[model samples]
Target: FEFIHPEFHEIVRRRLQTIIESRIVLPPVEQRLLRRDGSVVDVEVLALPFETEGGVTLQVTARDITQRRIAEAEREALEAALRQSQKLEAVGTLAGGIAHDFNNILSAIVGNTRLLLEDLSEAHPGWRSVKEIRSATHRARDLVKRLMAFSRQQESQRSAIPLAPLITEVQHMLRATIPAGIELTVRVPPDTPTILADATQIHQVLLNLCTNAWQAMPTNTGRIEISVTTLSEEAARAQSGTPLHGASHYVCIEVRDNGAGMSSETLEHIYEPFFTTKQPGEGSGLGLPVVHGIVQTHKGAIAVTSRPGEGTSFFVYLPACEAPPASFESAQRAVMRGTEQHVLYIDDEEPLVFLVQRTLERAGYRCTGEMNTARAIEIVRQAPDSFDLVITDLNMPGMSGLDVARELLMIRRDLPVVITTGYVRAPDVAAARDLGVRDVILKPDTIDELAMIVQKNLTGNR
Candidate 1:
C-alpha cells in the first residue's frame, strides 16, 4: 500500500516521518494513492507506533475531515465576532447612561444654584460663601454636562439651526472666557445652511477647541477661527474616509487654531475617553470624546487635522436639517411657574421640604409639607379634591412618589402632580410622565422654581 505511488511516496513519507519524529507523536495525514490504471483515490491515515521489549510495531488509520475543519473554523469566527459586538454594545450603554444621569444632575444644580444666588442678599455674611459655592458648582456642573454630551447620554432637542449664528454665539462666549492675550475670530457666512445638532453641544465643542487653542499658543499671541459651510454629502464622505453621509447634502463646521499642533500619536487617541494632556483637576480629557459622542448622536461625523509645531483644525460634519425652526427659547425649555393655590409637598429631605414650604408660603400660596409619605397620603385621602397641587419626591422608602401620585390622582383625576427625582433618566421621564406627572423636576431645583412649576400647573398655564 505504501509503495502504490512510487513517485510521491518518498515526499509524503519523509514529511510525515519528520513531523512524527520531531513531535514524538504523529497526528494524521491525507494521501492520494495513484494506481497503474491512472486513477487516484484519496486516503487518510492516523499513525501509532508501539515499541515492545524486543521489537517495534506500527499501525495507522486516517479519516477525511476537510468539511469538518471548514465548519469549525467558521463557527469559531462567528463566536469571536458575537463576543466582540456584545462587548462594544455594553461599553456604549454604560458610557451613555453615565452621561445622561450626570448631565441631569448638573443641569439641576447649575440652574437652581444660580437662582439661589440671585435670591440671596449681598449684605448677608454667608453671601460670599454661597456665591463661591454657586460658582464652583456651576463650573463643575458645566464640565460634567460637557462630558455627558460627549458620552451621548443627554437628550437633545432636534431642530434646524443656521450655522453662523451658532458659531457666533460660541465666539462670544470664548471672548469672555479666553485670556485677553488670545485673539478669536469667526468666519461663517450669515446664510450658511441649517444643520441638525444640539446648540449646547455645538457651543461646547467650539469653546473647548478655542480654549485648547489659547492654551497651546505662546504666552500672548494666537488666533482662533470658526468657519461653517454646506458640503456636498459626497465631499463629506470622502473627507471622513467613512461614508458619513450621501454624496451631496451635508453641512460642515471647522474650528481652526493657530497654536502648537499635536503630534500624530497624540492626535490618534485624542478622542478617547478620559485621555488628557492637562494637569490634575485642570481637565477631565472628555472634551474630544464628548465632541465625538455629540457628532455621532447627531448622525454626523468629526475629524481633526493637525501638523506638529504648526497648527490644528477640527472639522465636524452633520446632516443638514430640512424642517422649519422653532424659537431658541422654546427650544431650550424652562419649566413654568406653578399657581398660588393649595399645594401639598412630601419628601424625606428636611431641607428640601422646608425650602419648598418657605418658597411657596412667601409666594402667597397655601403650602403644606409632610416628611412621612404615609401621612401625606392620608391627608390626600381625606380630601384629594382639597389640594390643587402635589409635589413629591421619588424613591421614598415606604410609598414611592409615583405610588403617592397614583393614589392621589385616583381620587381626583384633575389633581396636578409633579415628580422630583435626582436619579431620573430619559426612560424614567416617560414612565413618570405617563403616571400623571404633569411635570418632572430634576433635583437641586430652586425653591422658587419648584413653586413656579406647581403654580403653573394649578393655574393651567405654563
Candidate 2:
C-alpha cells in the first residue's frame, strides 16, 4: 500500500477492500507503483479474496506493465501519424485537380492577353491596363504553380543554387510584408555551401517558416532570425536524431523566433493539415503542412523545438552540393519564327484549338486545329507527310496526347510530336519521351514561348 503511487493509493485500498468483502476476484486495474529509489513503474494490480480457515484474506498481485504501456503509446502515435498522412494525401489529390482546371482557365487568359498586347501599340491608352492584366495573370500562374507543388503534382526543377543569394531574395521579399515592429535578421556565412534544390520551392519553404514565426509573436514586437550554416552528415544525423542518406554535407537553414512558443501537445500536431493556433479568419492552417511537404519532397528534414514561453526554432537541413559554374545572362532575342511549316494541333477544347491555330499562323506557320483526336489521327494516317509537326493536348476526352503521339509515329516515324497539358504526371512524361515526343510543355504558355517551341521542334525535325 505504501509503495503505491500517491494518487492511486486510495483507489487501490478501496478495490482491495471490495475484493475481501465480496470474497471474489476483481478485474485487474492499471496503476502506477513508486519504488523506494523514487522511480515510478506502470503496473496492473489484481486483487483476489481467498477464504482460508480464518477469514477472507486478500491477495494482491502487481505485474510490471511499463514496457507494454510504452509500446501501446508508440503504436497509437504511429496510427495517428498514418491517419494524418492519408488525410494530407487526399487533400493533395483534390488540390491537384483544382489546380489543373484553374490552370486551363489561366492558359486561355494568358494566351489571349499576349495576343492583345501584341496587337496594341505602346501609345494605345489601354496598353497599360492590358499590361497590368498580364502581370496579374503572371502572379496567378505562380500561385497555381505553388498549389501544384503542394499537391505533389509538379516535378522539381533542381539546380545547384547558392544559399546566400536565395536567402537574400527571401529577406528582401519578407521586408515588404512583415510588420515594422518585428525585427528580421538574416545571417549567412560567405563560405556556406550550395544546395541542389528547386529555388522556388525552397523560397516557399523559407517564406512559410518566416511567416509562421512572425505570426507566433502576436505582440507584434519580436525578433526573428534566419541563419545558414553547414553540417556534416554525422552532425546532421545527431542533431535531427534521424539517419540521413546520400549527401555527405547538409546546409542548415534555421528560423528562430523570440515569441510566444508552443506546448508539447501543440508541437505534436503542428504538421497536421488545417491545424492552427491562430484566431478565427487569421490563417488557413496550411503553411506548416505545405512547408513539411516541400521539405520532404526536396529530400530534406525539419527539426523543430519549442516551449510554452521560450520561443521556437525550426532547423531545415538540405543536402549540400558542389558549387555550380558561374552563369551568364543571355541577351534577349526576338521570338523564333516558323518557316511556313505545316502543323496539326489537336485539343478537346475548341477555344484552345482556335487560339493555338491563330497564334501559330501569326508566327509564320501553316496551322490546322482539330478538336477530335480520332479525326486528327485519320487526317495524319491519310497523308503522313502532309504535316511537319503534330501538337496535341495531354488530357483529352478519348485518346490522350501520348496515344496520339504513338499513333502518329506509327504512320510517320519521323514526325515530331509536342504534348501540351495543364497538369502532367511523371509517368506520363516518361511515356511521352519513350514515344519520341519532342517536348512536353505546361499550359498557359506565353506567345513567345509557344512560337519558340514550335520553331525549335520544326527545326530539330528538319
Candidate 3:
C-alpha cells in the first residue's frame, strides 16, 4: 500500500515481510500513515499471514486513530499545566511565610537604627555605618515586596498617574544603579494619557526590565531606551502581539536594549518564577515573574521579543485613562512629638513589643507593651479611658489584632486603634476600616511613618 510518509514505508515493509516469512501474526503497533491526498494520519496497524487457494497471502489491518492521538496529546498538555500551577502555588505560600517573619525582624532593626541615628550627629564615625545599615534594611524590604508581589499577596494602591513623571523618576534612580558603560534614555510624549495604576508596582516593573537589559550585556556596555507612545487596541495587537484590551486606547511602554539578546529557548521560560539563566547567586530568577505579576495587577499585558545578537525589547501595555493625572505635591509633614498621651501596644513577638514600646517612649508617648493578647484586652478593660491609642500586630496566637481591636473599640467607641501587619491587603484594610479601626499600617515602617500614623489617628486626622 502507498504511504503519504514514504520514509516509514521501508520500516513497515521489513516488519511485514518478517511476519509473512514466519507465518505469524504481529500485534498491533501505532504508526503514522500517508493517504492518497498527501495527508498524514495516525493509525494502529497489524500484519498477519493467511493460507488461501492462491497460496500464502499477507493480510494487513489498519485502524485510524488520529482523534485518539490528538485527545492523548491534549490530556498531557493539561496535566503539565496543572502541575506547573501547583508548583507555583507551593512556592508562593512559602514566600509569603518567609516575608511575614522577616518583616517583623526587620522592623525592630530598622526602628532601632532610626533611633540610633537620631542620637548621633552626621559627623559621628558610627553615623555612616548606621545609615548604611538602614539602607540595607530598605533593600531587604524591597525584596520582600517583590516576593509578596510574585505571590499575589501584595495589594496595589491604584491612582491616576502621569506616565512621564514616573518614568523620569525611575530614570533618575537607575542612573546610580546602572553601570557607567550603559547609557539610559527616556522618551515620553506630553500627550500620553494618564493610567490608573500603583505607582510603586509600576516603578518596580520598569526597574526590573531596565536592570535585566543592563545585565544582558557582558561588559555592562549597552544603550537602554525607555519610550512611551499611545496606541489603539488594534495597533497595539499588531505591533507587539499584545492582546486586545477592553479599553479604547493603551499606553505602550517599551524598554529596548541593544545588548546580547536571548535565544528562542531561553525566551520561552524567562517569565517562569525561579527559572534563571544567570550564574548562581547572581539573581533570584523572580524579577521577570514579579514584573509579570505587577503588570497583571494593573490590568496590563507584557510582550517580549529577542534574538541572539539583535538584542531584546519588552513591550508593556497599560490601559489609558482620560482623567487628568492626580497632583502629588509634596507637603512637609511635621514630626509629631507625642504629648503625655498613653498608648497600648501588643504583639506576640516580645522583641517586637519591646522595640515598639522603646521607640514610642523615645518619641514622648507612654507605651504599655504586652505580648499576650488576653492580657492586652484585660489592660484595656481595666482602664478603658487611660490609653489614647492602641497599636496591635494583626497575626497573633489566641486572638488576632482584629479581635483585639474590636474588643477595645467596644470598651471605648472613640479609641483610636491601629492594626499593623507585615502583609497589606486591600480587602483587609477595607474590612478593618469598617470595623472602626483608626488605621492600618504595614510593618517594617520607619519610626517617622509609625509616629505619623499614630499622631494622625489620635489627633482625629485621617
Candidate 2 positional error at 119, Å = 1.5
What lDDT tens digits, residue by residue, belong to model 1 across residues 152-245? Answer: 4444545676777667767777788788877787777765667766766877777777777787776658788887788777888888766775
TM-score of each: 0.55, 0.77, 0.75
In terms of lDDT, the poorest run of 10 residues in model 1 is: 328-337
lDDT of 2: 0.84
lDDT of 3 at 23: 81
**lDDT digits (tens) for residues 161-253 of candidate 2:** 898877887898789998999999999999888899887799899999999988888888899999988999999988977678789999899
Q: What is the per-residue lDDT of model 3 for residues 1-107, given as tens digits with 9 covering 90 to 100?
A: 57726777777877877887788777788888888788888889887788899877877788999899889988985676677668778988788778778889899
Task: Candidate 1: list runs displaced more than 4 Å.
Answer: 1-132, 142-154, 157-251, 255-314, 318-340, 445-448
* Index of the highest-TM-score prediction: 2
* C-alpha lDDT of residue 43 in model 1: 59
Ordered by TM-score, highest first, the candidates read 2, 3, 1
**Poorest lDDT segment (10 consecutive residues) of candidate 3:** 326-335
Alpha-carbon lDDT, every model: 0.70, 0.84, 0.83
